[model samples]
Target: MSSSNSVEGSYSKRCAACKHLRRRCAEDCVLAPYFPATHPERFECVHKIFGAGNVARMLKAIPVQERAQAADSLSAEAYWRVQDPVYGSTGIVIQTNQEISSTQCELAKIRAQISMYEAQMATEQQPPPPGLPQQQGSLGSQENMPMFEPNDPFNFLN
Candidate 1:
């Protein structure tokens, strides 16, 4: 049991960062908790992009409590850098923002249509006073209902 525990302890001690660098992992090693031995590939990708020293420095600079979040963010940035050498994560962020804006624009248009439909329905259901002529057509007399022009994001309203 003692021998098995020693072997397990030794194996667990070699974190991905230390293993990749061919160095022993110290108990106080900042990267040890974030980059464990199980995922060497994660360390390799981060090392390739940010270098081991830079990562160590970054981790050390951050507050102890926030180090885990910082490490995860670094990992994500490294992944994005590997995927897109030029634009990296910023390109994906911009694209996502544009998509959100487009969806919001579409939603606005749909809401405008719903409002128009509801107004039209309301006018048609109500009887025109006692002496007024019976209104004809889908929109009845357009004078009563307010016109709604859906704002187009792509084209300017003239």
Candidate 2:
């Protein structure tokens, strides 16, 4: 007989972070199943802080929970508030191996941008004293200059 509905089948990639925490990684996370088709990235999760920021923000919103399960990620205060005898809060602890989840092209783009900025900064930097006859930066002529002379840098440089 044909057992098509049997448990023998393939599975899709689930949200890694949610899976680690044993949380109900339902249809909420951007990396949920069939993500490549359904949620074609709003933004790459690479070095960009948007995804990390989102998770950090979510952690903040979820208040602390006391007497939490070892696997759950919720705070103690939050756990106590909604703690149930049957349903344990095991899916709270989120785990991840990667720091930056961005693509190669995007990483290159960010690096290039940083390099350009560094170059620009180096070029834009002006010497404290442009090595000209170290006169006071003031436009006042010698006759009009203040009598209280700050030690002239020209004396030392020359």
What shift in Å separates residue 132 of candidate 2 from its native position after superposition?
Answer: 7.9
What does candidate 2's lDDT look like per residue over 78-148, in tens digits? Answer: 34334432333333221121323446567999999999999999878956566667556677467875554
lDDT of 1 by residue, 97-120 (tens): 999999999999999999999999
Which residue runs does candidate 1 get wrong by more than 4 Å?
1-12, 133-158
Tell me the lDDT of model 1 at 19: 91
Q: At residue 148, what lDDT does model 1 achieve?
A: 55
CA deviation > 4 Å runs, candidate 2? 1-102, 128-158
TM-score per candidate:
0.68, 0.19
Worst 10 residues of 2 by lDDT: 40-49
- Minimum summed lDDT over a 10-residue window in model 1 is located at 149-158
lDDT of 2 at 147: 57
Q: Model 1 RMSD to the real structure? A: 14.2
Overall local distance difference test of candidate 1: 0.90
